[model samples]
Target: MEFIARATAVVGGAVALVRRIGAPGHQAMGPSPQIPEAKAQGIMTLKMPVARGWKEGHVPTCAPGLAVNAFATGLDHPRWIEVLPNGDVLVAESKEQAGPPRTLMDHAAQATMRRAKAIGDSANRVTLLRDANGDGVAEVQEVFVQDQNQPFGMALIGDRFYLGNTDGIVVFDYTPGATSLTGAGRKLVSFKPHGHWTRSLIASPDGTKVYAGVGSLSNIGDMGMEAEEGRAAIWELDVASEKARIFASGLRNAVGMAWEPATGTLWTVVNERDGLGDETPPDYLTSVRDGGFYGWPYSYWGGTVDDRVKQDPALVARAITPDYALGGHTASLGLCWMPAGTLPGFGEGMVIGQHGSWNRSKLSGYKLIFVPFANGAPAGPPRDILTGFLSPDEKLAYGRPVGVVVGADGRSLLMADDVGDVIWRVTGA
Candidate 1:
């Protein structure tokens, strides 16, 4: 096992060096990112950071005119968040479900993730945080729901509270101001579990439908398209009839979804495929149209063919171009719509939690960013909202930001830091 780990690291470093020299491309960020030609690599790069929790009096660096505080801390793998009607905060304390490594590559990958503290047994629970005193910190903490199958998303529509479990959408009777879910939940929609296990969900504007993101089972469908049925797409579920249908297709891994208030359109942040050099494809944020298809497996960024997987000319031709690129392998997982003036000096736009990168030589993300918008569309470059999650030498990570949302007060922003096990609240300094 030690020999395999050392061998993989040596080969990965060499391949990464060669790829970097050959492509030496510009940073693939912003609306128009440079998409280089794909260079296939058999051995995956694994430049992961060693996990290092924050020391005393340490906090992430916030942008000027902003301040950050620990809203809640000492939680277990908090990955997602939802604001309740009565101003309570719901945090999905979960992690990746560990499966036995089947191949040598899988063993190496699992070891890498373990060392980074990125993979672990799922916590399968949700906790509630209440800040009754109006301070930025959460004064009360309690378990809201338990025994879930790796819950990642939560939504409350009318008297129904929807929980996004790995294998299905579960609905429970919700009473306003309730702290704990006591009633049994009924499965609203079923999904295949394991591969890309995050099931992020959002309710429609009118609260009539629920949208869930299902990522592809394998990168570029290496496991065959049959294994990808009803995968790599967003599904819309009808609340009244309990029926569901594919709203959009070919989104590789759409983890965060938000409703754009300006145009009332649904928007999402997608994590694109990997192993295609350092900057061949970029993860993106875009407005999702009903029945629209964004390219995956066959192509990307509006008809630029990946030349990987089996070709589907018809699907590739109709693939929709994303609105903005958030850099390659940034793993931009958390997104929330920000109205104008929510943060002083910042305009209406989106706040993204880039979970950082492990597959690239030099890392990207590991921070929070804001994209400016005008007339309901992205109009300018993105600005940094938070940073300093990595060590000075970039060899260790103190925290990784995941789910981001507007605080219950509607002024501050709440972000989930899985590595640090803390919920950070960002407000004007």
Candidate 2:
């Protein structure tokens, strides 16, 4: 492990000198903008911001007319957030299970994970936070669910609660205001795990079906395409039948998903392929189509072919372009829509939690951003909603924002800060 880590460090340093250049951050965003040509690198770029964490009485910076505070603190690594019907928030305190490296790339990936503070024992639990009396803090906390395998996404339908474990979907009977789950959950379906284990879950508008976003087994099919079956795609499952099928394909890593309020269309924020320089193949947000392919392995950003993979002209031709580009190597993950008139200045649009970059020379996307929407599509450039996750020097990150969701009252935003192990609440000042 030591030898592999040292070798990767040496190779990464060499790769950084030849990093690809492209459009500036702002020019790469919005409905229509420039997408620079991709420049593939032989070795993956390895630039991770060190985790410094926040000091006492400190929190992330909020945009004008807003205030930020810690809602819950001193918890395990909280990655995803789910707001229940009764205004209680459920936080998935999770981390990837550490295992032996299988290859040189695996060693490099593990080193990156350590630098990003992503390597740790899975918490395998969800904690409930109640901010009663509208105090902007979680005064009451309880263990809502426990003993799971790296739980990420969560959804509730009628009396059924669903959790997207790294390897499968589990179902439990839910009751309003319940403090903890005692009954053993039944497995709804199993998934092929190993690579990109975060399975983000969302329910259909009508509550009859559920969607699970399973990421690819390797970057650009490095492990052969056969290992990628049912991966890098969204699986649609019928609640009654326990049947599942791929809803959409070629999404490298759809970590966060939401329903656009205006058109009732499903949308997702995808983490695009890395190692293709700092500015190629921008991570994106788009409205997910029922049977659409968004380009992966064979190509990216619609028909822009990645020369590294074997050519598939037919697949590339059918690939659907994303709605908006977040930025290259931003590692954009969390997605949620705020209703119109919910917050001043920030009207109807989607809020994304950019977990930040580990492979970019200059850091990008450690903050939470709001992308304005008009008629159910991205209308303007994304605006910063929360900032200062990184230090002024940019060498260290105090925290990395992950899952985000509008408060149950619709007047504020709640974000999960995994590096700091806190849930931050952003509200109108």
Top candidate when judged by TM-score against the true structure: 1
In candidate 1, the residue pairs with backbone N, CA or C atoms under 3 Å apart (3 or more residues apart, or in different chains) clash, namely: none
For 1-429, candidate 2 gives per-residue lDDT tens digits of 556555665676556645534424443676565777676666667866667789998889889988888999988989999999999999999897767788677789787677667886788999999989888889999999999989999999998999999999999999888888779999988998767889999999899999999999888998789899889999999998999899999999999999997789999999888876666778999999999999998888888899989888999999999999998878888889888777777888999999998776666899999999888899888899999999876667899999999999889899999999999988888
Candidate 1 lDDT score relative to the true structure: 0.88
Q: Please write out the lDDT profile of model 1 over residues 284-347, one tens digit for every residue.
A: 9999999999998799888889876779999999999999998889999999999987888898
lDDT of each: 0.88, 0.86
Q: How many clashes in each structure?
A: 0, 0
Error of 1 at 395 (Å): 1.1
Regions of model 2 farther than 4 Å from truth: 1-27
RMSD of candidate 1 to true structure, Å: 1.5
RMSD of each: 1.5, 1.9
